[model samples]
Structures are given as structure tokens and as C-alpha cells.
Target: MFAVAAAAGQTVRNAAQRQLTQTLGTVGATHVRFLFGFPFAVVFLALVVAWTGTPPPRPPAGFWPWVASGALTQIVATALMLAAMGERSFLVVIAYTKTEPVQVALFGLVVLGDAVTLPMAAAILVATAGVVLMSLRPGQTASRPGETAGGGARPMLLGLGSAALFALSAVGYRGAIISLPTDFVTAASTTLCVALAIQSVLLSGWLALRDPPVLIAVLRAWRPSLLAGFMGALASQLWFLAFALTAAANVRTVALVEVLFAQGVSRFAFGQRSTARELLGIALIVAGVVLLLWVH
Candidate 1:
């Protein structure tokens, strides 16, 4: 349930961020998620602490590196994703990001020592294949006409890079959350607050130093940016909660449903119709998600 809500919230947040990218550019738009989301994250942490009657856990010596990795990689991933969104349809961009589950499984193994069962591994492969099929569907190239025949390659590469970075970010966040010696709710909330704080400072400082105008633009567009931030923080909170309960691979593999949410946004909101191949890809993704859940 948390994963489903997170996916839906994330889909809306992505749409909001994508719109901001047009005016603020990718970095500024990415910053909006962290900067504006920080307040909400603080509120969430306070609520968790209040409810639990426990103070936030102090980080161990190793905690900073894990949370910092999560924060930095997430900022990079959001920037890459927004850049890709500028070049591709929302559904296509998100479909490409759906490839993160496989990468998440790999990263989780290496970074957190989280092991994937054989069935989960098979499900990840199936879902990954669906994402690739959706991304490479025959008519996908029609949108890019200005450059040479290889014009489509740039967005594809950006999407894949975004997927890899997002996967790493997920692993890092999960690692940070689990490292905390607290209840799941408190741990997830505290980790979220710290990570968002780090991201907010890092991105805001960079924007201040390098591109003041874009930061001003983000502030000028505060209404939508705030909405995006709220949704982004809400989604992250739920995602962290889910991560506390399961392996990063499980959380991310189930997140493949975000692609389906993106499809709905494309069809109803943008009047785009799915091709037969895209429909098949969606089915495969659904099947993989169901298998993963059953095995879990």
C-alpha cells in the first residue's frame, strides 16, 4: 500500500517537476523537490517523534556517508530524469526509469549486501525486459526529428543513466535507513529528514553559486514548485517507510508500477494512446510485479 501510494505521488510530482523544468531548467527544478520538500520532511519527522515519544536517533560514525550518498545521487538522478523528460514523452521517460529495479538489485547486493532470491531475480529480469521493450518500441523515435537518425540515442542514454543513478540512490537510502537503531517509522522519518536536509543544502548552494536566476525563477514559481515539493516529500516518506520493511530491490521492483501510472497520465492527460507493443509491455511489467509480490 505504501509503495502504491508512493508511486502515485511520485507520478504527480514528476509531472510537476517536468513543468518546472521548462522555466527553471533541470537543476533548479530538481532543487525545488529538495528545497521545498524540506519543510514537509521536518514536519514528518516531528510527527514521528511526537507519536513515538522518542527522540530522533543520533547517527553513527558511518551514517553520514550513506545518507550523503543517497542525497547526492538522488539529486543527480532527478536532474538526469528531468533532462530526459525535456526530450521525451512522460510515459517514455518513466518507462526508461522503470529499469531501476534491476540496477537497484545489483546495487543493493554490492552496497548493502541485500540478497535477491531466484524468484525475485527472475521477476526483476522480466520487468526490466518490459521496460526496455516499452522504451524501444518502434514508434518511439518519431518525436526526435531535428538531429540525425541517431537523435533518439541521447534521451535514451540519459534515461538509462537516470535509472542507474536512481537505483544507487535507492540503495543508499535503504542502507541509511537500516543502519539507524530505531523503530521503522522513526528510522525512516529520521533518515528522510537528514537526507532531504543534505540535498536541500547541496542543491541550493550550487544554484546560488552557479545560477542565481534559476533559483529566483523557482521561487517565483513557488505555487507549483511547492506542490511538487509536497508530493515529492510525501512520496519519499512513504518510500522510506517501505524500504524500512523490505529490501531495496523489493521496494524498487514494485515501483515498476510507476510506469503504468505514467501511462495513465499520458493517455488521459495528454491524449496519447498506447500501441499494442506498449500494452504488452505494461502487461509484462504487471506480471513481474505480481510474481515479485507472491515470492515476497
Candidate 2:
């Protein structure tokens, strides 16, 4: 349930960010999620504390590095995501990032000692194959001027790189939450808030120093950024809750439903059409998700 809610919220957030990317550019758009979302994260944390009667998080020596790992990697992954959204068809772009489940399983096994059974691995592969097929559009060419000679490959590179980094971030976040000596509610809320705070500070400082104008632009574009930020925080909170409950691999594999959500928005909102192959890809992803749940 947490993963489903997060997927829905994230689909909305991604659409909002895709719009922001055109106006703010990639860096500014990425910063908007952290900067504007931090306040909401704080609010969520306050609510959690009030409801749960838990004190603010007091970490020992290790929590900072773990949370920081999640925070920093998320920023980079988001930038790559926005870059991919700039492509001609966002449906395919989204399909590419849906590859994260396989990578997340690997990261979780290594970092969090989460074991993957043979059946789980098979489910991951089935789902991953669907996205890979969608990402490999026939006769795809460089849609932008700055693309390399292997222009067709740029989206795949961006998407796969983004997937791998997002997988690592998932592992890092889950590890941070698990290491905390607190209930799942407090741990998830506190981690979400602190990670956003770290991300906001670092990104804000860098933009102020190197891209003041873009920072100003981001500030000026507050209305849309607010919407995006709220959805981003909502999604992160739900995702953290899910992470607090299960392995990152399970959370991410189910989150593949975002591709189906993306399909609806792509056709209706973005005026982008998915090829027949892409629809086949979405079907395969759904099959894999069902198999995973059944196996679990």
C-alpha cells in the first residue's frame, strides 16, 4: 500500500518536474525538489513527532554518512532523470528508469544483506527486459544537437546511470533507517527530513555560488515548484515508510507501476504516444510485478 501510494505521488511529481525542467533547466529543477520540499519534510517530521511522541533523531556516529549517501546520490539521479524527461517521448524515458529494480536487488544484497532468492531474480529479469525493450526504440536518432555519434544510445546511458544511482540511494536510505534505534514511523520521518535538509543545504549553497541567476529563477518560480515539492515530499514519505517495512528490492520492483502511470500521462498530458512495443513492455512489467507479489 505504501509503495502504491508513493508510485502515484511520484508520477505526479515527475510530471510537474518535467514541466519545470523546460523553464528552470536541469539544475534549477533538481534544486526545486530539495529546496522547496525541505519545508514540507519538516512539517511531516513535526507531525510524526507529535503523533508518536518521539524525540528528534539523535544519531550516533554512523547515521550521517548513510543518510548523506542517500541524499547526494538522489540529487544526481534526479538531474539525470530530468535530462531524460527532456527527450521527445517521456514514456520511453520512464521505461528506462524502471530498470532500477534489478539494480536495487543487487545493492540491497551487498549493502543491507537482503537476500534474493532465485524466483525473485527471475521476476526482476522479466520486468527489466520489458523496460529494456521499450527503451530500445526502433530507428531512434539523436533528438538534440549536442548528442554524440551514438546519439540513439544517450537515453539508455542516462536512464541506466540514473537507475544504478537511484538503486544505491535506496539501499543507503534503507540502511540508515534500519540502523536507527527508533520505531519505523520516527525513523522513516526523521530520515526523510534530514536527508532533504542535507540535500537542500548542499544544493542551495552550490547554486548560490555558481549559478545565482538560476537560483533566483528557482525562487521566482515558486508556485509550480511548491506543487512539485509537496508531491515529492509526499512521495518520499510514503517510500520511506515502505522502506521501513521491507527490502528496497521489493519496494522498487512494485514501484515499476510508475511506468503504467507514466503511460497515461504521456498520452493525455504530454501529448506523447507510446509505440505498440512500449505497450508490450508495460504488460511485461505488470506480469513481473504480479509474479513478484505472488512469490513473496
Candidate 3:
């Protein structure tokens, strides 16, 4: 449930951020998610604490390292994603990142000792293959037949690098949550607030020092930025909760629904027509999600 809801909200958030990339550019748009979302994260934390009547827990020696790693990597990941969208269609860029589930599984196992059962591993591969297909455009090839084509090698690299960074971030956040020794709601909410705080400050500092105009533009576009920020914060809150409940692998694999969501968006919002291959890719994604849910 958490993964599903996160996927839905995230699809909207990604759309907003990607569109803002046109006006704000990559760096400026990337800052929107963190800088604006931080306030919402704080509110979420406040609400969580008030409802539960529990103060935020004291972080252990290891907590900051984990959360900070997540925060920093996520900042880079969002930048890479927006840059990749510049290379290809938004849906294809999104599909490329679906590969994160496999990396997340490996990272979670090694970093946090989260076991990946065979069924879950199969689901990851199946869903990832579907995404690989979703990324293709007919008659576009890279030196050979049956190969995935990109705008260039650079865009492919950007998408893949984004996937790796996102995977690492997911593992880091989960590691932080596990180290907390608190209930899922409090742990997830508190961790989100801190992670956003770190990302917000760091990104704001970079913009202020190196790209003041972009920073100012981000502020000027406050209305749209605020929507992006709220949707991003809501999606992340749900993602953190999902991370607390199970392996990051499970959450991301199921989050493949975002691909289907993107398909709908591309069709309706952008008036893009889908090819047969892309439709099949969407089906495989659904089937993979169903299989994962069934086995688990």
C-alpha cells in the first residue's frame, strides 16, 4: 500500500520537476525538491510527533552517516534524472531508473543485511526487463540490432548512474530507519525530516555560492516549486514508510507502477501515442508486480 501510494505521488512529482527543468534548468530544478520540500518534511515530523506524543529519538552514532549518505546521493540522483529527461522522452528516462530495484536489492543485502529471497530476485529481473523494453524506440539503435538505443551514450550513462545513486540512497535511508529503534511512523518521519534538512542546506549553499541566479529563479517560481515540493515530500514520506516495512528491493520493484503511471501521463498529458512494444512493456510491469505481491 505504501509503495503503491508513493509511486502515484512520485509520478506527479517527477512530472512537475521535469517540466520545471525547462524553465529553471537542471541544477535549479533539482534544488526545488529539497529546498521546498524541507519545510513540508518538518511539518510532517511535527504532525507525527504531536499525534503520537513522542519526541524524536536521539540518533545513535551510526544514524547520521546513513541518513546523510542517503540525502547527498538523492540530491545527485534527482539532478541526473532531470538531465536524462533532456536526452530522451520522460517515460523512457523513468523506465531506465526502474533498474534501481536490482541495485537496491544488492545494496540492502550488503549494507543492511536485508535478505533477498529467490522469488523477490526474480521479480526484480522481470520488472527490470520490462523497463528495459519500455525504454526503446523503434528504429533507434546503438551499432546493432536488438540493442537499447539512447539519445547517446552519455544519456544512457546518466540514466544508469542515476539508478545507482538512487539505489544507494534507498539503502542508506533504510539503514538509518533500522538504526533508529523506533516505530515505523516516527522513524520514517523523523528520518525524512533530517534527510531533507541535510539536502536542503547543502543544495541551497551550492546554489547560493555558485549559481545565485538559478537560486533566485527557484524562489521566483515559488508557486510551482511549492507544488513540486509538497508532492515530493508526500511521496517521500510514503517511500520512507515503505522502506521501514520491508526491504528496499521490494518497495522499488513494486514501485514499477510508476512506469505505467508515466505511460498514462505521456499518453494523456503529453498526447504521445504508445507503440505496441511499449504497451507490452507496461503489461510485463503489471505482471511482475502481481507476481511479487502474490509470492509475498
| Model 2: colliding residue pairs | none
Q: What is the per-residue lDDT of model 2 for residues 1-296, given as tens digits with 9 covering 90 to 100?
A: 79989999998898789889999987899788888998999999999999989987697668888899998888889778767666554645566677899899999998889999998888888878876776565665555787543244676678778888999999999988988899998999999999999998999899999989999999999998999999999999999999999999989888877778878887898799888898898888888888888897
Off by over 4 Å in 1: 80-96, 139-158
Error of 2 at 18 (Å): 3.2
When superposed on Cα atoms, how far off is each prediction in RMSD? 2.8, 3.0, 3.0
Sort by TM-score, top down from the best: 3, 1, 2
Alpha-carbon runs more than 4 Å astray in model 2 = 79-96, 141-159, 270-274
The best candidate in terms of lDDT: 3
lDDT of 3 by residue, 1-296 (tens): 89999999999898889889999987888788888998999999999999999889999989999999999898889889878777654555665687899999999999889998888888888888888898765665454343355455566678888999999999999999988978989999999999988988898898899989999999999998998999999999999999999999999999988888988998998999988888888888888888889888
User: Relative to the true structure, how large is the alpha-carbon lDDT of every model?
Assistant: 0.85, 0.86, 0.87
Taking all chains together, the TM-score of candidate 3 against the true structure is 0.91
Cα displacement (angstroms), candidate 1, residue 289, comes to: 0.6
Clashing pairs in 3: none
The most accurate candidate by TM-score is: 3
User: Cα lDDT for residue 87, model 3?
Assistant: 60
Candidate 2 lDDT for residue 138: 68
Residue by residue across 249-290, what tens digits does model 1's lDDT show?
Answer: 888878878889999999999999999988988998898889
